[model samples]
Target: MKIMTCPFNGPRPVSEFFYWGEIRPMPDPATCSDESWADYIFNRNGAPGVKQEWWCHIASNTWFIAERNTEKDLVLRTYLFEEEL
Candidate 1:
């Protein structure tokens, strides 16, 4: 079983967190084009690299960011959502 370290709360079971989706460069829907909307909403490339993904701490009801190393099945970094930091 893989372990996930929450940047806010420290180590926890992977199953305790839910994979929300990819962290987008731009999250606004009104400004996005049709193709961009489709890609953001439905398309995802399962490639190996540093990817920004959304993760929700189900038990805590908190949301956070996870920088994932796909090839290694490792989380490079994790952090709480800070609008400015």
Candidate 2:
């Protein structure tokens, strides 16, 4: 079984975590055009590469970011959201 290291809860079975979608920037709603907003909501690059994504621990309700390689489906690192700054 695969293990995912949670920033707060240490290592756990991958089954204990939920895969959230990729992390992407959102444009300012006030200044963004309708087309831009629509594209942002519906479009995805879908390229195979390293990307940041969100994951959550089921029992602890902890949310964190995982830097992963899409091609290998390997999680390179896990960190708290604030630590990304």
Candidate 3:
């Protein structure tokens, strides 16, 4: 029953959003070894904390970032890709 604000569409039901994985920097593939590249593609930091992640409004297919706390399942804020740090 949680409501999430979409940067383009304003407030919407949480059900309308898809939880994409955490936003992390991709290693430089040109210089990265096979193991490192594989790690980058397969590994995830499972630590609990406020994390910036990608979420899409499925109905609109619009993508945005949400700063959410894992422990409480609380979303601190949501913004467009360009609006983030």
Ordered list by TM-score, greatest first: 2, 3, 1
Q: Give the lowest summed-lDDT range of ten residues in model 3.
A: 76-85
lDDT of 2 by residue, 2-65 (tens): 8898999999999999998899899998999999999999999799999999999999999999
* Cα TM-score per model: 0.78, 0.92, 0.91
Question: What's every prediction's RMSD, in angstroms?
Answer: 2.3, 1.0, 1.2
Model 3 residue pairs with clashes: none
Candidate with the larger TM-score of 1 and 3: 3
Error of 2 at 69 (Å): 0.4
Ranking by lDDT: 2, 3, 1
Clashes of each: 0, 0, 0
Candidate 3 lDDT at 82 equals: 85
* Best-fitting candidate, scored by lDDT: 2
lDDT score, candidate 1, position 81: 80
Give all candidates' CA lDDT scores: 0.83, 0.94, 0.93
Question: lDDT of candidate 2 vs native?
Answer: 0.94
- The TM-score measured for candidate 3 stands at 0.91
**Candidate 3 lDDT:** 0.93
